[model samples]
Target chain A: MAVLLALVVAVMLVGGGIFTLLAAVGVVRLPDVYTRMHAASKAGTVGSGLMLIAAGLHAFDFAILARAFAGFVFFILTAPVAAHLVAKAAHHAGYRLSRHATCDEMRDHTKK
Target chain B: MAAIVTGLIFAIVWAAVTGSLSPLNLVLGFLLGLFALWIIRRDFAGTRTVVRPWKLLSLLILFVKELALSAWRVAVLVASPKMDLKPGIFAFPLKVDRDIEITLLANMITLTPGTLSVDVSDDRRFLYVHALDCSDPTAVRRDIADGFERKILEALR
Candidate 1:
């Protein structure tokens, strides 16, 4: 049982670490604020959420696990809100899309 | 009726949060729940809609699936040696009008595959979404309208 629990923790930790690393890579590789927000909001959220769950499991206590779950829920619920606000602000501030962008419908709509 | 239900849910949550399921703990939780309800009742007034729990569960399942797929896709895109991304923002016409429904849809889109909701129009008629790949905006638009938007309508309305 102990071995299994340890294995689970190890897996969670490694998986979470890999995801967080990928998100960082995405932030650097992606061209602009909007695309980067995708990485920061989604991958970043899951990475941290997994680690939080792993921490809760390591304690092997029900209450701690529940609280950790609650934290994960709150984290996901708020991440997009923050990301949306930032993206909206960037757009309004005239931060242009990457040169590789295919099209921007929002820009067209605002023009009309 | 809604108030009682909300209070009960809150009480259960309180018990979980307090890390105890004892009878005393539950009663304390119930009282606290009622107190909380009293405080926030005005904010939620006149917004009670009948909730379909099963549909909501389905929505949750879909969200989980999309979340995993999104992470994998981002990881793959990020890891590839040659990045060929066409990122841009497009307007998604709003189908669900209620504040809660619109908010939920936006949040889900942000978490799902390659899509991040940037803003809502001043009139709330459209949602601006940025996609990591805008090579086929029509396909992406259809996917959201069919997938998340449809599911949200079923679950919430």
Candidate 2:
């Protein structure tokens, strides 16, 4: 049982670490701020979630597990909202995406 | 009724797990549970209901999907040059009325990279958020309203 638990924890750590590395890359390489926001919001949340889960499993305590689960829940609840706020801030600051971009929803709303 | 039940269950679980039901620890647990109940009561306005299993399953799936997509995007971004950032703030109209719901929304916004919830309007209708990279303000607003807002509405409502 201990060995099995260890393996699970290892897998989670590796997965989360890889995801974090990918997120860092995306933050640097994405064509625009919005895309980068996408990278950060998604990767960061998952990586953190996985890490927490691993910790919970390793601790082998219900309270720790519950707390970890709660943290994961919190991450899911907030990540997208944070990303949207960042994107909105960038747009208001006059950040422009490539001309290939298609829609502009906030602008239309403001016109009304 | 719920509080008493929860407290009783928690006490039993705590005692069983720790093997020490010292008076001090028992009192502490009760106090913590009371605090949790109080906070929940304040935010939910006395409306209490059992959580639906299906909702929890769906939420878990949604979170996984969002995580994978975001990870891929971040990988690409970090590999690029010119590091051009367009940061600014925009007011977001909120549909959630419950204090817990709103707080959850605010925390969610803050957790996502490159964004932060700055302020809430006096009337509580709009939230001002700052974005690290704002490619399109309107798109951002719509995404928040549709994505997070929609999910939160479903979960909390």
Candidate 3:
């Protein structure tokens, strides 16, 4: 049982670490603010959530589980909304998509 | 009010399962009790988050698939000798109006391969999303409507 629990924790930790790394790579590699925000918000939250789950699983203690869970909930709630705000602000500030970008409805105001 | 009810339920369940209300157990119960209440009341009072676990599982699988697929696509686009990309902002008309529903749709779209949820209109009638490739706006809108929003409605309702 202990071995199984350890394995589960290990997997969750590794997976979360990998996804967080992927999100970081995406942030560096992606062309523009919007895309980078995609990496930051989506992968970032999932990665953090996974790590918190691992923490919760690794320790059966209630205090640890409670703290981990609180963090998880906070992350899940705040990250996406923050991303949306950043994207919205970027749009209003006229952050154009990359050179290859094909549309800018905000610029034309036609999308409104 | 709902949270109180949920917390009490969690406390009773914890006590029952452990067969002892020791101090540690009580503390654990209290801690988890709050969490349980929060989760239980987060979406709706007197209602549940989603109706079906199987449906949520399907959604999770689909989401993971989309995540991997999109991440790969974006990575390939970035790694290619020449970048072939067409990005744009498009207004995805909102059919899901509830705050939670809209939030779910937006996050799902953002996490998927090539999109980001930017904002919703003042009236909550339109969700403005930025797509990494807006070459086919119609196709994009159709995909979102058929893909994320459809499943959200299915599980949520």
Candidate 4:
């Protein structure tokens, strides 16, 4: 049982690390702020969220697990709100989309 | 009933904060919750919504599945040699009016595949979303309508 639990923790930790690394790579590689927000908000959220859960599991205590779960929930709830606010602010600040972008309906919507 | 639900929520929060879920602590937390609710009873005002547990469960399941898929897709895109991306922001006409509903919808969209909600319009009629791949805006709109928005309506409304 202990060995199995260790294996699970190991897998979660490594998976979380890889996802986080991918998010970082995405932030650096993606062209514009909006696209980068996509990388950070979604992938980064799952990455850290998984690590939090793994930490809780490693503890092997119900209380710790509950606390970790609460942390995860709070993190998930707040991350998107922050990302949305930043995206909105950046858009309003006149940060243009990347040259590679296909279209921007937001500009059209605001024009009307 | 709203008060009972509020008390339950308080108890759970108390447990999480205290890092203990023992029965004694839970009872104490419940009593504390009742006291807190009584103090703010006027503000509470019994605002109630119908909660379908099964629908809620399904929404949660869908969110988890989407989270995983979104992460995987983004990872693959980031790792690829050539990212033939058509990133753009499109306006989604809002069907859900309530503040909570719109917030939930937006949050879910941000966490889903290739989409991040930027802002809601002044009148709350449309949500502006940034999509990593916006080659087909109609398909994306349909997916949001069918996937997260539909499930949110089922669960919350």
Candidate 5:
């Protein structure tokens, strides 16, 4: 059972690392601010969460588990808000969206 | 009542799981759990307000969009010829008043590529942010207010 648990933890860490790496790559390859934000926020948050969970499992202690879980929860709660603020700051600074962008929410906001 | 009970349970569980109920570890974990409860309680203080599910959903979507967009921008800037960057500091007036919300906003700005929150105004009225290549200032402010601020206000209000 311990071996199985170790295997599971290993897989989680590896998978999370790969996802985070992909997120970094997406940040490099994607076009424009909005799209990059999408990749970074989702990948960063979920990847970090999974990695922390794996770390908790590897430790196999309740205190460490609680700390890991708490950290994960904090990440989930904050990542989105941070992303939104960045985008909002960029938008407010008059950065132009790609022509491909279908909706212009900022324009609507200015009229108000 | 439940929070206190859960706090005690967390302390006891952590102590047993670690098998080292040393006075130090127990005291530390207990303090940590108490801190966690304080944060959680403060965040959920106003239960009487109606929740806005759509606002929450939109906030998530906006964050994802911004992350992808910022990363790409940074990559291009890194690859571009002459390494030309018009980096400048801009002050963004914040409408969100809550401490948790403002902290979240500041952290988000700092995490996004090509931008960082440098400082907050003493009065908490504006945020000072540095942009890597600031070609246009108005659009940046609009993005901050309309794109992020609006969603946060909706969800937290």
Candidate 6:
């Protein structure tokens, strides 16, 4: 059981670490606030969630697992809301997408 | 109604699994139960969605697969030496009106790669979405309507 738990923890940690790193790279590389927010919110959540699971398994304590799982749930519930607000604020403030962006349906909708 | 009872029962099961009967244990169990029911809700006879649990699980599996695929696409785009992309914002007219439904759809979209839910219109008729690549708006709209919105309706009633 201990071995199995340790293995799970290790795999989750590594997988999560890579994802988190990718998200960081996205923040630095993406063209605009909107795109960057994509990287940060999505990858960040999955990465953190995996790490949280790893923590719970490593601890092997019911209370710890419950708390960690709760945190994971909280992250899922909150991250998207946070991203939505930031993106809304950015759009309303007139932050344009990268030059490669092909359309702006939002502007059209808001105009009419 | 069934879901709540299932959650309560799940809490008891959880307490047994963990060998504890504390209130906290029960609460945690309840949460797990709720989560479980939310996932397999279709299997229960009293479930409003009334789809197979496997179907619901498959939907989620598809969603996660898409999530990873999009994330990878974004990652590759960013890694490319020259970043040439067209990021556009578009109004995605919504089929869902209820607050919870709208919220769920928006969150799922945001969680998936390359899309962000900006805002909903005053009357909740349209959701303003910013797609990472909006060259094909038709495809994006279809994907949302057929995928997230459809699955949400299936799971919740």
lDDT per residue, candidate 4, B32-137, as tens digits?
A: 9999999987864655567788999999999989989999999999989888789999999989988778989999999889999998999999999999999899
Top candidate, metric DockQ: 4
Candidate 3's residue-wise lDDT over B1-157, tens digit each? 5466657667756765565657788668867999766665645664455456688779878987886576556555554566566778888889888877898898778768778888787888878888878999999999999988988888888
Candidate 1 vs candidate 4, TM-score winner? 1
Alpha carbon deviation, residue B14, candidate 3 (Å): 12
Off by over 4 Å in 2: A59-66, B1-30, B36-157
In model 4, the runs with Cα more than 4 Å from the true position are B31-47
Docking quality of model 4: it rates as high
Please provide, for model 2 over B1-157, each residue's C-alpha lDDT reduced to its tens digit, 9 standing for 90 to 100.
7788777666655554454568877777777777777777766566664555576567556645654554554554565565565655567889887677787677656554444565566578877665656667788788788877787777656
List DockQ for all candidates.
Answer: 0.83, 0.23, 0.37, 0.84, 0.08, 0.48
Distance from true position, residue A52, model 5, in Å?
Answer: 1.6
Candidate 1 per-residue lDDT, tens place, A1-112, comes to 9899999989998999999999999999888888888888888899999999999999999988888888898899999999999999998988999899988888888889
User: What would the per-residue lDDT of candidate 2 be over residues A5-87, giving only the tens digit for each residue?
Assistant: 99999999998888877777776666567656666777767887899889988999876776777678768776766665666
lDDT tens string, model 6, B19-122? Answer: 67799888999998898878875655442433456657866787778766766766676667886667888889898877667987898888776788999988
A71, model 2: CA deviation in Å?
A: 3.5
Identify the runs in model 3 with alpha carbons over 4 angstroms from their true place.
A1-4, A60-63, A66-70, A110-112, B1-84, B155-157
TM-score of each prediction: 0.96, 0.56, 0.69, 0.94, 0.49, 0.78
Q: Which candidate comes out best when scored by lDDT?
A: 4
- Model 1 interface CAPRI class: high
Query: Scored by Cα lDDT, where does model 3 land?
Result: 0.77
Clashing pairs in 4: none
User: How does model 5 fare in lDDT?
Assistant: 0.69
Per-residue lDDT for B1-157 in model 1, tens only?
7778877888788877878888888888888889988988888888867688999999999999999899888988898999889888888999999989999999999999999999899899999999998888889989999998998889877
DockQ of 5: 0.08
Q: Give the whole-model CA lDDT for all candidates, comma-separated.
A: 0.90, 0.67, 0.77, 0.90, 0.69, 0.81
lDDT of 4 by residue, A74-106 (tens): 888998999999999999889999998888888
TM-score-based ranking, best first?
1, 4, 6, 3, 2, 5
